[model samples]
Target: MTTISKTRIDGMPIGLTLALLLACAVNLAVLARWL
Candidate 1:
């Protein structure tokens, strides 16, 4: 996980990127339940 994250653009804040990833996971979970 650490290695993959290291390759991201340095212009973006890590915290914001992590939040987006978390939000995506939450959305996927919600959709999975409905399906």
Candidate 2:
């Protein structure tokens, strides 16, 4: 069984970083299309 601890902010940083990366990629794509 896998147990996840919600008390730590460990996973949040990684998840946020990935989300930011994806958002930046999408923004870049849009800018490219507009150019």
Q: Please, what is the whole-model Cα lDDT of each candidate in the order they appear? A: 0.82, 0.75
- The TM-score between candidate 1 and the true structure equals 0.69
Model 2 residue 24 lDDT?
Answer: 90
For candidate 2, which ten residues in a row score worst on lDDT? Answer: 1-10
lDDT of 1 by residue, 1-35 (tens): 77666676355788988898899999999999999
In candidate 1, list every pair of residues with a backbone clash: none
Expressed as tens digits, the lDDT of each residue in 1-35 for candidate 2 is 13454434345788886787799999999999999
Q: What is the lDDT of residue 13 in candidate 1?
A: 88
Write down the RMSD of candidate 1 (Cα, Å): 3.6
Off by over 4 Å in 2: 1-12
